[model samples]
Target: MENKTPIIALVDDDKVFQLTASRTIKAAQLTDKILQFENGEDALVFLKNHASDSETLPDYIFLDINMPYVDGWMFLEDYSLFKTKLSKPIEIYMVSSSIDPRDVDRARNNENVRQYIIKPVTREKFIELLGKAAA
Candidate 1:
């Protein structure tokens, strides 16, 4: 078997969060490839287009709950429909600023979501999550 660097996707509408999180991931040296999407729709399209391409498919996705279009829940709904077609398994983490219990509980209930993370994820946390995925 060959070791392959994991690819990460950041799906969020917040530009600041995207920039900061990407920088943090880079600083942690988690992955050299990072995909950015402004909303779930875009992420979904990307995933669909690359469903059979393991090299292009992301190993992990950091999803935001709120966005202009296709929020995290909506994304998960659609993703579940076609996830089996994907060439590789992708771990999804719900990363949101909303600390609402309802939001957390809803995400936790979703089968596709591996974890629900609060906003402003620390570099160490990113390392831990990505490291686990890579492992």
Candidate 2:
């Protein structure tokens, strides 16, 4: 049998965070395919375009709350509308720097969001999240 690696998407406006997180994810060796999006709008477009292509869709998404074009909340709102059309289930984790209770509550309440993870996720956390997704 061939081994299928999980694809991960990092949707955030922070270039530094994207670079650091990508490095951490790479070090974990959970997957080699990492997609980067500067905002939720681009990520949403990608998801929509690949809705029927499981091979091209990401298995996991790390979404940031604040962004220029489209925020995480907005992305989730749009995503919920067409989630059922996706060929494969995508686990979305709301990774934000915001510590506001409202933000946490909102993310936790979203059915599409797998979990709300705080920003600057450690290498161990990346492994844990990716391992869970891979499994």
Candidate 3:
């Protein structure tokens, strides 16, 4: 990935959302390495390995709340365990198709999560996330 473009880790169980988000992000030209995953479990595995590698980890992660097996919330709980591995707090954004107030409320309280945004992510929001990651 280029140093100029931000890297984003996109975790969602839905294949459609993952593909759409990845396409939209690249279409906006806001990121270079926009990793896609079908579940939070695999995403977490990748995150762990990436953090251990010498290379810099992803600057941002877009997490989906509703998924089979290890959901986004569970991932967050586990992510906290690896908090010490990071030099700074990794920017995480909750992206979901559901509009549940409780889900939004829960995500807001998580210090690692920066935003709780509804899916069908647009160029503007994607760009905004890139700015946050860069900051």
Give the number of the best model, judged by TM-score. 1
Of 2 and 3, which scores higher on TM-score? 2
Pairs in clash, predicted candidate 3: none
Q: Specify the highest-lDDT model's number.
A: 1
**In candidate 3, how many clashes are counted?**
0
- For residues 1-135, write the lDDT of model 3, one tens digit per residue: 355656678888888887878888888888668778888899888878777653456668899998999999999999999867865456889999889999999999988799999988888888787866666
Rank order (by lDDT, best first) = 1, 2, 3
Model 2 CA deviation exceeding 4 Å by range: 1-3
List TM-scores for all candidates, in order.
0.97, 0.95, 0.89
Off by over 4 Å in 3: 1-3, 54-56
lDDT for each candidate structure: 0.94, 0.92, 0.82
Better of 1 and 3 by lDDT: 1
Between candidates 1 and 2, the one scoring higher on TM-score is 1
lDDT per residue as tens, model 1, 1-135: 687778899999999999999999998888779999999999999999999999999989999999987998999999999999999999999999999999999999999999999989999999888887667
Clashing residue pair totals per candidate (backbone < 3 A): 0, 0, 0
**Ten residues in sequence with the least summed lDDT for candidate 3:** 50-59
lDDT of 2 by residue, 15-125 (tens): 999999988888888778999999999999999999999999998999999999799999999999999999999999999999999999999999989999998899999
Q: What TM value does model 1 have?
A: 0.97
